[model samples]
Target: MQFTQLKVLAVSGSLRKSSLNRLSLESMKLLTPTGVEFLIYDKLDQLPFFNPDLKNNPTIEVLNWRKSLKQANLVIFARPEYAHGITGVIKNALNWIVSSGELLGKPISLPNLSPRASIAHAQLSEILSVMGGDILESCSPNASLITPYVIPCDTAKNLCDIAVINHRIRELWNRIETAMITK
Candidate 1:
């Protein structure tokens, strides 16, 4: 009934500091259940393009990225649609690990930022699935309607979007626990 050492690693396709997707990940961190550490990976830019030659001898950044993937019990991705497809940065990161098989059997939560991003999410889902990741459908938050707004607000409706994010995370935690127990 109790779980420990749970670390959720979040990676967003957007590199911009002001990206709504990135801010959503930050918000999700606040709603993590006790004892579950949520971390956002911010070094995607430092990783080089995936190269077969470099795989034999990877740089420190690449090494660290792969290590982070291995360290996480669950990997959550918040990606925005760029031309109806995955962002180059996140795709590149995936390419780096696809051949290494570090994420095989790893549970990944893909929060589809709906409306504007369903295509990108579907594409990413197929990609991760091919790479052997177990995508948790319950954790897939359809945040199409929730605008990323974090500020002092008078209306309860403004704050309710945060509830949407929290609800998705809670669903993820519950399903993960159920899966672990059944296994």
Candidate 2:
């Protein structure tokens, strides 16, 4: 893809302030390369439950969410798995845009914070693919950081303290840049 500027929209499924998934995205912001705009879509919790009836006139929050997705060159998601599946919060967000097709042909990176959550990762990949998103397999790394439901700390500093986690974050960004060049 040839672009004048690359805008990346990062999203976290967890609503908690101490979520490692969100912390990881924050760390990613610090390592974002120049000329790339990294924005975190933090209003997933504000979106109303997906109902087909509201397609004609969606809520303001839904409109804003779709706008961000449509405007981004890439979408990076860092979500924690729940009960061996994707969290309801992220799933609900995707459902809101499934019919609108905002993710159609968009590059998506769904990085798993917990290595044990393979089932959720696969489910998310399938959902994104069904939404017509180009799942960047190379950029989606199994960043072995936390367990399925545990929060290490409240700050990105705690998550970035581990050298391996930091490397994985940097590598994820590198893979994203490389994907942009080779797309």
Candidate 3:
């Protein structure tokens, strides 16, 4: 079998240390297919809200984050539902990239870690579409949690429901690889 290398950048909508969304990203890293590499963004909290008024010069952090996204072959967003929609932090981070058009036409995946993963999936799809992104697919694990805490190691066996989430992630990577090679 032949596989292509893909560099994927993953961003979580949650900033809390024990966020299930962040844990979902970790699970993705552990489950990535061969020839694929995943990088998780750990500083979403450091990003300032998008400001069109500060147009003359962009901050180093913002510029660097945008650069990373531009260099990535695929973008994955693991997010949670906040009051029936995506979190403000994730929305704000995306706003910063909207003007650069870095995500335009980029392949994206939105995976949810909440009990209401469907809500998160729909909300993120709308947000990404408005920003001009191409969403490859969205998946939600059956191991959704009602609370914000991380599932204990033993109980966490299903936290990511590896079978389902990994399959979707693999599919996305395959699509990304095909697009990269065909382009």
lDDT of 2 at 167: 73
Higher-ranked by TM-score: 2 or 3:
2
Clash totals, every prediction = 0, 1, 0
Per-residue alpha-carbon lDDT of candidate 1 for residues 8-126, written as tens digits (9 for 90 to 100): 89998899875766766776665566677788999999999888888889999999999999999889888878898999999999988988897899888887765677789889999
Top candidate, metric TM-score: 2
lDDT (0 to 1) per candidate: 0.77, 0.84, 0.69
Clash-forming residue pairs, model 1: none
lDDT measured at residue 125 in model 2 versus the true structure, 0 to 100: 93
TM-score of 2: 0.90
Q: After TM-score superposition, what is the CA distance of residue 12 in candidate 2 from its true location, in Å?
A: 0.3
The runs of at least 3 residues in candidate 2 whose Cα sits more than 4 Å from the true structure, single-residue gaps closed, are 1-4, 144-151
Best by lDDT: 2
The lDDT ranking, best first, is 2, 1, 3
TM-score of 1: 0.83
